[model samples]
Target: MIISSPAKQLNSKLSSQEQEARQNGYLFAQLVRLYHTFDGRPGNEYSKLQDAIACVLDKIDQNDHPYAYTNKLVMFIEARHALRGLYLSPDQNKLLIDLRENTKRTNLNYVYLSAIDATSQFK
Candidate 1:
């Protein structure tokens, strides 16, 4: 889905930190959209799920633009917390827990993969 022009303009004017916030907001919006589409599915929808998640992470990695960094961190933290509360298999839950723990030490690439895995399992 296309991000709104006004939002894009606003995002373009943010600081690096602020840019992260805008990216998180955009990512959260996309996840909500995905949830609506895959809310009651059975088994895993790996391909589309990964694509949706990658889109968000790609935006995050493309942090050359201005952003709301604090806001993005807040949103990402909140989203991750909420996601942790959803029903998941033990392995999926473990993956999320690992991702959360590792995020403190490593870059966020694995977080994207964990998101895809968790959403595929639970959503």
Candidate 2:
């Protein structure tokens, strides 16, 4: 005999919409951890945030969520500027529009889950 739990059934039916519903907060937290990792290590924290964004840009398609993703990125850039209060350009909004769109990101949920697991180790 075999029985599946409701949660199991729900997990099996998750589509891109479900994935889109869940934003990448774990990844964002990991990035923030990395950004603040060098508080006294003598390097530019802003550059570290740029590197984090670069890593994300390498993995994510621009069409992942367009306006939503761009807004999130803008927030990241804003967070990085909190200390300096610097007025600067994110330079990622236009690229988010221009980058080629993918019809599907088959592994986005898996990626997010992995991020959650990876970041959990920090606790």
Which candidate achieves the best TM-score against the true structure? 2
Model 2's alpha-carbon lDDT is: 0.42
Q: Which tens-of-lDDT digit does each residue in 16-109 have in candidate 2?
A: 5566544444334443443444345444655555564555543434334333333344445555556556444333333322221221233333
For model 1, the local distance difference test gives 0.43
In candidate 1, stretches whose alpha carbon ends up further than 4 angstroms from where it belongs are: 1-14, 42-123
lDDT of each: 0.43, 0.42
TM-score of each: 0.28, 0.31
Residue 30, model 2: lDDT of 41
In candidate 2, list every pair of residues with a backbone clash. Answer: none
Against the correct fold, how does model 2 do in TM-score? 0.31
Model 1 clashing residue pairs (backbone):
14-67, 15-67, 17-68, 17-69, 18-67, 18-68, 18-69, 19-67, 19-68, 21-72
